[model samples]
Every structure is written in C-alpha cells, then in structure tokens.
Target: MGSDDQGNNDVGRSGFTRRGFIQIMGTGAVSASLAGAAIAARSKPVPPEKVMDAENTVKISLHVNGAQHAVLVESRWTLLYVLREAFGMTGTKEGCSRGECGACTVLIDGIPRYACMTLAVEAEGRRITTLEGLMSGEQLGPVQNAFLEEDAYQCGYCTPGQIMAVEGLLRKNPTPSLDEIRIGVSGNLCRCGAYTHIFRAAQKAADLKKR
Candidate 1:
C-alpha cells in the first residue's frame, strides 16, 4: 500500500503531477473570472445625469460693438463664428481657426484676444470690439486711417487683426517706441511681408491719436 501511494504522487511523463495540474487549472479559472468581472464593470452604462452637455445649445447675451445682442449659440461655437455668422460681421477674417494666426483677433474689454480661440459663451457680459466696430458713422477710426495712409497691408488679409492689435497697444501706451510697437503687434502675422509698413502705421496711429 505504501509503494502504490508513492507511485500515485510521482510526476507523470508530462512532468506535472495530478495535484500540480489541478492547481494550475484552478488558478487559470480564477484569473478568467477576474478578467470577466473587469470587462463587465467597464461595460456598465453611465447614468444620464453624469453625461456632459457637449451638444446642447445655450442662449447668451453678448455685448459687442457697443450694442447688446441676444443670440442662441452652441457651447462650442467660437466668438469668430458668432461674429461672422450670427451678427453678419465678416470683417473679422478667419485665417487659422487655431489662435496662432491672429487673423481672427478681437478686443475683449479693450484687450486684444484671438476670437477663434474664444468661445461665444465666454464673451457674454464682456465688451467686444471687432474690425467692423472701428468705424464712427462710415468714417474709419484713427488706427484704420493710419493703416490706410501708410499702406500697411499688402494682401489686407491680416490688416484687421494688425489694426486691432495696434488699437489695443495705443490704448495702453499712447506713445510706444519702435521696439514697443514691434512687441505690441507681435502676435499678428502679415504673410505679405508688410512688417515695415505695419510698424510705420502703428507709429502714425500714435501721432494721430495725440492730435
């Protein structure tokens, strides 16, 4: 009886005893159960209340160009899109939808900001000035006049943003030096290589504001 027990405990030709094979099978079954539990947890549906409002439209009042506009806009709608589409203020060009181009520049509370990057909902309760707002009863503003006189733009695609940047700069520093002027409009890019004229126009705008 002792010899028979010893033979039963010995490793088989497959190198695994009956007890060892049973242990491995049990471990594999446990691992499979854990994996199935994890998969089931991940597949569970999220509650409706926990969902985000990414697709919903919201009504917002925007104070733009010294006027109040009550408009319905989606949460993701950009200020640039609202200005051009809803308000019909297409003067604010859309070059790079990304903020890098500065083509969609606007003034929020007298500060230059990229409208393409700014959401329409964010502009609520803030004063917004676009390229179209820089006109006084069919007459161009001082900065616009300076740009026109100096021929600051070649293609004129970047002219609106450049003018707005200069306007914001001169509001803070009425007498900015050449270097200061360069830094002021640095965010704007003129693909027409009109930096020289643009800088000259900014200087002229400073002088014009003084008069």
Candidate 2:
C-alpha cells in the first residue's frame, strides 16, 4: 500500500479505538468507585452513642383506677396495649382496633375513650377507669348489680364497654332516658342482641343512684 494511504487508514482506526477505549475505561472506573463506596459504607459500624440512644427506653406513669403504674413502653404503643400487656388488665377488649368498636372502652377523666385508639402517652397524668376498677372491695359497684338484675349481657364480651358507657352517661345526665341510654351505648356492639337488657341496666343504675 502507498505510504499516504497507510497513514490515513492508521489515523482512522486510531480515532475509533481511542474513543471506544476511553469510554470503556471511564465506565469501568465509575463502576469500581461506586462498588468501593458501597463496600465502605457497609463496613462502617454504627456509632456506639447512636446505638445506645436508639436502644434507650422511656418510662410512662399511668394513673389507672386511682393507682399509679410505671410502665416501660414504646412511644407508639396504644393505651389498650399498655393496659392489657404491660399491666395485665385485660378487661379492655380489642375489637375493631381502629376505634370503631367500643369493646376497648375506658374512662378518661370520666369520659369514655377508645383505649385501643388512645395513645398511652396521651393518657399521662389522666385518671383512667377500666372494667377491672369497677368493684368496691368485695362488693360490685351499683352498675354491676344493675347489669345482673337486668340481665344486661348475653355474650358478655361487650358487657364491660356497655357498663362503662352507662356509667359515663349517668355521670353526665344523672338520669338518662331510655333513648338517651341507647344512644350512649350505641358505640358498643353486642352481636348477641342484648341491647334491650343493656338499656334497662342503665335505667336500673340511675334508679339506684337516686335512692
């Protein structure tokens, strides 16, 4: 081949080779750098201080049924969990966990609240009344006696919530009519069709309070 032609061919091949070689080398270096960074990040240990802080827990004091219980719980735990799991007071039943069912009912400052939906932290320094606290020593509270007299419960799973609601209603209205009592206990569900007896129980409680 002629010298000029050979020189031109060499330049053309060199241009393509240099472009492709640079691109391959650039890609390889970038990949290697990324891999090294990922490995280094994985190898680095979490600081002891950070780990300790993350592991640290908080103490919560609950005034439940006129008694104080200091419990250790996560910040996100609901009052129902604290009452049931931490304190062993399982009277607060778990039903419709998102606050629909009143099975997890408890009194906060004499008002009915869905314990499952109420945060334990929110209940700090508040007076809480659970079904466990319904009795006075060996004798059942007036509401309890009324429940028995009126045959208020069929399944009894909703009895605690129903009674709590009745107590709150009487506390507010002092003498709730039958309709008022029904509306008050509406949040509670008795799948066994005991609502009529439940309403009668509330009236009985009101009568007992008057006498």
Candidate 3:
C-alpha cells in the first residue's frame, strides 16, 4: 500500500510495537507495583516481636499438642528449635530454614505455618501442633495412618511437614478436591516427586475421616 501503511505495519496493529514493548511493560510494572502497595496496605502487620531480632532471652509458656510447656528461649530462636531441641519433638524436619521449603511446617492455631520462620517468643500463648502431636496416646491419628497406608513418603525427610500440612488442609477443608489438594500441598516440596501418592494419602485421609 502507501509508505505510511508500511511503517504502521512494521510497528504493530495495536498497542506498542516490538521495540516499544519494553517501554509498555515498564509502565505496566509501575501500575502493578501501585496495586501491590494498595493490597499490602490493607493486610495486617506481622507481630513486631516477630520482626525484631531475637538477641535477648525470654521465658514463655506454650500450649503444644494439649501439653503445656514453661521454657526459656532466645528471642532469635525459631519455634522449630524449641520444638525439636528443648521439647525434643523431632518429627518436624528442617529443610530450608528460610520458609521456602515446607519441611519445617507446623500447625499454629489450626493454621499451617513454617516453624523456621516463626519466632519462639511470638508463639507464646498459642497452640502449636507438631507432627508428634498427631498421636493419640499410643495410636497414630487418622491423617498419619492414612499417610502410612497410602505410602506418601520416600526418603521421609519431608514426610513430617507434608503430613502436618495435609492435616491442616483436611481440618479446614475436610473433603478437598484433587486440585485443592495439589494447591494445599504446593508449599511443601517433595524432592522425590511423590506428589501423586501424597495426594492419594490426603484423599484417603479425608475418606478415613468420613468413616
């Protein structure tokens, strides 16, 4: 057609041209950041002590798995430490202490939390449930039983966290869909790639609860 038509065709039919796409993306990123800020502003703040350095030692009482503990802990020590070291609850594993790996997952107030990321002092007066807490006297709970029956673990390093996470999921959503199961355990990584079996065990756990 005309020379003008040729130039427009080289650019783009609509929106930015290929070379201008970077500029458009840069502007879009700004808008996205503003929207993110708005969302963050509405979110509740994390506890101050949770953010503060754990330099000082503090005595705190914890209600864990229906048992009460009166212990002294460092302000910097994570909940995982007290559970595994002081309390001697070794069911919780330490994968990545940075919260990226759910191997240290535990239940706090019925919610799944990364123990390594949670300050021991912050856990005071709250209910903390570790994997060992799932036992009922001499018997393993249904979730744990289902995990065993379904053979959801391999290497077993991530089993404790995986089981606890699934326990939390079933507590909140007793009959979660498969997709929900996948999403629920999304935070917990299984290097063995035993996800299908984990999902099976989670579904089995839900079914076990029904009976």
Candidates 1 and 2, the one with greater lDDT = 1
What are the per-residue Cα lDDT tens digits for candidate 1 across 1-211?
1123235433222122212222212222334434334433654323222222688876776666666667888878999999889877777899989888888989987889999999888776567888766765445678887876787877788888999999999989999999999999999988989999999999999998898
* TM-score ranking of the models: 1, 3, 2
RMSD in Å for model 3: 22.7
Report how far off residue 41 is in candidate 2 (Å): 56
**What TM-scores do the predictions have?**
0.74, 0.72, 0.74
Better of 1 and 3 by lDDT: 1
lDDT string, candidate 2, 1-211, tens digits: 1133224333321121112212212222234334334433644323222111333456776667656667776767889999888877776788889878798899987789899888787777566888766654434567766876776776677778888888888889998888899899989988989888888889989987687
The runs of at least 3 residues in candidate 3 whose Cα sits more than 4 Å from the true structure, single-residue gaps closed, are: 1-55
Task: List runs of model 1 lying over 4 Å from the truth.
Answer: 1-52
Among all windows of ten consecutive residues in candidate 1, which has the lowest summed lDDT? 12-21
Candidate 1 accuracy as TM-score? 0.74
